[model samples]
Target chain A: MTPQAQVVEVRAGRTRRRGRLVAAAMAAPAVLVVCAVYAYPALSTLAYSVSKIDLSPRFRIEGFVWLRNFINQLTDAHFWQATWITVYFGVMLCLLTVVLSFLIALLLNKTFFGRGLLRVTVLLPWAVPPVASGVLWVQMFHAEFGFLNGLIRAFGGEGGIIWLGGSTIALHSVLVTEVWRWIPFATLFILAGLQIVPKSVREAAAIDGAGPWRGFRHVTFPLMLPVVVPVVIFLFVWAMKVFDTIFVLTRGGPTRGTTTLNFLTYRQGFVQFDFGNAAATAYLLSALTVVAIAGLGWMLSRSRRLAGM
Target chain B: MVGTSLARRLKRVLMYAAAVLVLIVTAFPLYGIILTSIQTEPDIRSRDVAFVPTYIETEHYQRIFDEASGIPVAESMVNSLVVALATAFLTVAIAVPAAYALHRMSVPGRRVILGGFAAIYVLPTLLFVLPLFIAVVQLGLYDTYIGLVLPYTAFTLPFMVWIMGSFVRAIPVEVEEMARIDGAGLRQLMFRIIIPLLRPGIFAGLLLGFILAWVEFLTPLLFTSDLSILTVTLGLFRSTMDIAIGQLAAATVITALPVILITAIFQRNISEVVTAGVER
Candidate 1:
């Protein structure tokens, strides 16, 4: 090749390399901030899980014990209790949210009067801050002067069930508040999914003389499942990590009936000042989240395959 | 035919009735809170509560502003506004370039970065907050606005990048190539050409990030104990016991007002963002 052509080729290679360098430079700030603020701390917490850390006089990381923290947490009865409670809460919340959202979506999918107004009203609950929702429900569940009891009395019934006072009842009360906050979000998702269903398919189902239930079961639901499955997983993960509403409403109280893994981590780190144990709990919760998400994904794919068959 | 028409009419009526029932269930708490905020203190405390306020009083709101109420309502609101706005600005500013690099430029490990961000998004906040709480103290940033903004920005960056990157990817590569051929530098191409196209995604990201940071309770609760650093959500928890029910209701309404207004104004954009994030 001529010297001029060789020089041009070398220059092109340099420019390409320069472009990649520029791209990396542009991306560096976000990467650095995430690393410094999120990734570093997360890794250090994992480190804390294996070592003894205390922050009384000053922050100090003692020698690593190497799995003792995990062993301790694994053996603790309270850990098992919190795990069971978390799984139950997550599952129940996910089921209720998805089912209720699907129902609401069906209601919303129809062309009806005042549909726009109803849509806005449904979203209002979700717009309220979770902490405020917790406080609002706490007052509503007040035994002496709450609106719930007042309505019950106005209807000529004996009132004043201790909604947030009993152990088992308090967890359900928290569940109610969570379900209230989440339903609107899930509804919007499912409603969006429903809007994408083709008109011809429904018409064909009708022409086939299938009733509404059968049409929905055979055509509409299968189409919506792919959309709904991800939402279900999202809600399940969200419910498992819930801390704000329960913290405000019950504070994981009434004999720890409502304490999930997330709350347990908070209780250990902040209240008990056992940073080691807290980190261990946090790690375990992360592991569980990974496992749950993976398992859910596998199950969803398997179900889709089975349905296809 | 007549029987079918009647059945259709009946079904319509039932649908409307069910819709109204759902609306009432959805809106009752908001209505109750507003009513409580305007009701007399005696009405709130009494067993026989007034379903409708006989006299709509502003005493609760007045008490919230009163110096004797022992709550710094204005200061906390300002703190919340500062932290939220700062977080939104920082997140978008950092995310826009990163998104451009990931989507428009030939960046290595793009998939890995995206996957890592999605994973980070799902992990419990406590996982990071525990070590962050200790680190913030050691770094002497505890109880500072910077401390709050730092974590808020970090937590919000991944989602912002994801959203903005989707928008960036939608811009035709030919447009960017033409701009570059015309001697536009990378910065000029991004700022002069790409940003105008990315307006909706940027607005959605800012609003989402701001709302998330504004509503956040745990981070502030853990990181900052100073009264002045408390946001509105954290402030509500502080005076939950000390304040009367009426004043607490007022506080709740005040805390929720900005969010309500934003949602009302940007309802379509917000919903679009949410649906887009999920659909992808």
Candidate 2:
């Protein structure tokens, strides 16, 4: 209306803009810190993966040898062996974690006496600290003084199998420990999904003459995929990055059997003091992780957008 | 869904038995720890596994309160509490305003910050260890409370930003405009009006941040080694590395006691905190 009123309106708009600008200003410091923290090691590792590194004080820089580190990593027989073992370890945990937990979730969802108490108990391992879980599992899997061996003997099997002490048995020990720690997490997420699934939906499907298996396959299974798939994919990523449990129980094994990518990164950087090679390996791991996570997340977000969930 | 009510009842009976098995599998470790702690060393090693001890003793637990070290467990317990509480305060202090800016404000980089959620969450902690180690060493903050506290906050701040951002967005911007209309300045509105409304969000962020910081290990394990800075888990791990097997199990039970006690005591609040997370 009036010139003074117009000027006041514009000024008020700028001030409000400043208030909202606080979020960006605050976010700026955190982003810089995260990027700097994340990028330096990532770039350093990528650089090292290509070429050799000197442990000397001179610490000379070199050009990209172009996949030489990966070649070395892959070509060495031990490296290839470790890779296969790592792959197997990752797969067993990932599959068992997803499948068994899904079944347990379905079972837990049914009406039962003391169900609430059981749900909390399922989370006990999850609540237990990781290192403690590792210790417990190791002790249980121990050959002489361990529970599993004792139980096997009690049941008339050969006792004193070296679960963590034997090369072949060590990976199995690591797997058991990993599964123990993560099953609870998977169960929790699935249980959350089951809670969200309306009773009427499941009951109505049953009312429509679906068998128990078919009812789950059609009614509950589809309802669960949205929650379950993401949990599995995310946990798969975590399983790849696993460190403490394996390091604790096997310490890269009876003969480097349990050494994982992360464990190798630590060994290279800290133990070997080969910063360059460690940096390179770290970057490769980071690149692989970011690609997998970003790709899947983008796909999920797009689908969620379409479904408007 | 069953053809007959009798058949449906039978299915429930079978399910109940299976559920009992699952319950035992999960809870037995906890039972084992408490059982092992009080029993003599021979008792644990003798039986295939002792389900029940003939006697319960306080020697294992009381050792925490005994000795001249003034309960090493207590010190580490305090260390964990200090880090966790400070992490909660520091993360919220930084993240709340950042969230408000990102959620309420439409700046040039708003979309970039919002999209950062997935990137931040999925980035494994291992990748950052190298630089973070270097940064802490350079800052001369290594092995200090601040060293552990800062990184713990950074690790958890992403969740804070996301959860608080969603919570802030839900509350209408009308409240801020009302405060502004009353001649409240930017600082006034944020501190006086907006923050009170963000109580639930802040509480949620604090609980999540506290639990994460309290339980976190690798970062602290790598970065800090000072006895003063050792966490409950760290102490448990370091002690267990070379000691009596029963004592190790005892320590495991001891370390877990706080989390279990807290969760058992505040089950409702814990769920509420996670609920805020899932909503985001």
Candidate 3:
């Protein structure tokens, strides 16, 4: 209402505008880099999925063929097989890792002698690169001289079995290596969840004549699940797109047994030089990832609401 | 009371036993890799599997460093170092200001920017790498350090921004207000007050970014075919047939050492970063 107040209000507005301008300037570089590196490539891949492109001899983009690559992928038996294998591998790996890590987290939650050292030891597998771990496991499972066979032989049992040789077993062997690398990571998350459980809640359950198992089932497990579910979903999505470990361990394998959708895409693109088909497969894989991520986000929000209640 | 105490002791024993079992399972492969790297090639090939090496040798280690051995161990290591360091530095440099702005400033569409970043994080690397491979070639950047560094930076930026934003938001606004009242400019306020408080997040981002880039396999594999530009991870995969088992083990050790050390030193930061990212 007064002239003095009007002047102060205008000054405040100008200062706010200056602040907004500075923020925009600060954020421009990251936005530019993301556009150049991530958004551009992602959009190009979507475009390539529908059009034929050849990188060999010379780079050329032919006319668009709508849904042809997708149709070919859908009709191809190898694509379906790869899809089945990818789903199977992801489901099996997620279940095993979650169970094993939950048990490990339970054990680690209790105070014991040498607990600190044990924690570090448990995480050792995660520190190794997935590709290097694959190489190590391949040696460990070597038919003749591997430590596994040697142990079997020392126990007075037959020592030779082709661990990575069989079509069925190669995929399973790759699963084992991945489980080894991922369990510790999962355990760390679960353990952190465990620590956040209010001790008083479990104590109250105990005072009400509940036993350890009952208390954990009714109180601890529910509290921990909200934290653990997102982790499981994230790991499942990661396992679905697994490439490096399988590529190193089996090269998608003795008879394409371990060729999941991700590997199949790589094989089509790089090995077969069919960029269109590869992009199509990759886009299909992305669609699956998006579904999984959406499911995770929904679960997370629902759990947060329940926790708030 | 006595019965309950006895039960407690029994449970403690069982827990420790389980802990030891987990430790053995996790550590065995690491031990095997180290033992294999130090053993003579003949011993590695011998029918009798020695849990402890009967004859230890350093020849494999020497072979990796020797140019005459025809292994690109040294070159690959240098390449990995350059690319990883560049990626870490560039990611932090770009992410810090953006995270600060997003947190402190009245930026419109903050949620959309964050959601887009998270969505990019979830997308498979294969999805981007295919198109990126073609782009790099067309731009004449293939087989160069920039080829690998660009993708690595892009891949790491999303999570780095999230982590750094959390750090920025935790800083009390009153400190910035006081500095502003004292006539400090925007740069002065950030460098003198905000940046010092952000040390932990910045260090964590650097280490996390470095590890991700260091262990990356696919990007380097697709972007570069030159052996000289290959990272140790790609080299390890490439040299499986060409090198002896001992030398292969040596190379694996070389590739894994930095990651292991960084992880060990920054265990708290890493655990915090991962749990924060997921739990949020």
By TM-score, how accurate is candidate 1? Answer: 0.97
Which pairs of residues collide in model 2? A23-B101, A45-A279, A45-A280
Rate residue A207 of model 3 by lDDT. Answer: 98
**Residue B171, candidate 1: C-alpha displacement in angstroms:** 2.1
Candidate 1, residues B1-280, lDDT tens digits: the string is 9999999999999999999999988889889999999988888988886787677899999999787777788789999999999999999999999999988776778788878888887789899998888888888999999999999999889988988987887789899889989999877887899999898888888898899899988889989999878799998888787758899999999999889888877878767866775556
lDDT of 1 by residue, A1-309 (tens): 899999999999999999989988888898888888778989889999999987779879888999999999999999999999899899989998888889888999889989998888888888898899988998888888888988888888787788889878999889888988999889989888777667788879989998999998998888777778888888988987899898888899889999999999999999999989999999999999889999889877875675462
Residues B153-228, model 2: lDDT tens digits: 8788777787788778878878878887899977788889889989978886787777788778788788987877
Kindly indicate the candidate among 2 and 3 with the higher TM-score: 3
Where model 2 places Cα greater than 4 Å from the true spot, the runs are A1-9, A44-67, A153-158, A294-309, B1-3, B64-71, B170-185, B226-228, B272-280
Query: Model 3 in CAPRI terms: which quality?
Result: medium
Chain A TM value for model 2: 0.86
- Show the lowest summed lDDT stretch of 10 residues, model 3 chain A: A300-309
Candidate number of the best lDDT: 1
TM-score for each of the candidates: 0.97, 0.88, 0.96
How many Å off is the CA of B200 in candidate 3? 1.5
Task: Identify the candidate with maximal DockQ.
Answer: 1
Candidate rank order under DockQ: 1, 3, 2
Clashes of 2: 3
lDDT tens digits by residue: candidate 3, B1-280: 9999999889778887888888888889898988999998888877577787666789999998888866688989999999999999999999999999988987667778878887787777778888788888989999999989988998889888988998888799999999999999999998999999999889988888899999999898888898779799999998787759999998998899999988887777778876675455
Q: Give the distance in Å from residue B70's predicted Cα in candidate 3 to where it truly belongs.
A: 2.3
